[model samples]
Target: MGKALIAGVMRWQNTLDLTMSPGNVVAKPLEHVIAANDANKFIAYNNIPPDIPKIKTKSNSKANKNKC
Candidate 1:
């Protein structure tokens, strides 16, 4: 999966004579490669919600709970 992504970026860079910058090559063409591979269909099937779940505790919280 990762190799395909890098290959896609390199192909795009070569075709357009652009430098190897992430911003220019990563998002858009990676999206195209994903779509072309039908990954979006699987993603749609999962239907994951667009919210980050809040962590109930942090490292400091664990230390407090341990209470020496």
Candidate 2:
């Protein structure tokens, strides 16, 4: 499975194994990739809450660029 650098942003992942024979470097099927994602979700974001709290980006400071 592809390492979760961030999160699974794309549907496809390069799990192509190069340790085996040169001819065996083919990518796995989409179903396997999807399953890997399912397993990865828990390990990756397990510490995070189900509904991540939104950060308050609004600021009343004069330095705010969007104040206009």
Q: Which residue pairs in model 1 clash with each other? A: none
Note the Cα lDDT for every prediction shown.
0.42, 0.43
lDDT of 1: 0.42
Q: What tens-digit string does per-residue lDDT give for candidate 1 at 1-68?
A: 13232464554222332234446655555555345463453333223333435454463244545558
Clashes of 1: 0
* lDDT for position 61 in model 2: 35
Q: Candidate 2's C-alpha lDDT?
A: 0.43
12-55: candidate 2 lDDT, tens digit per residue: 55554443433443433333433535354432344344556744
Query: After best superposition, candidate 1 residue 61: deviation in angstroms?
Result: 6.4
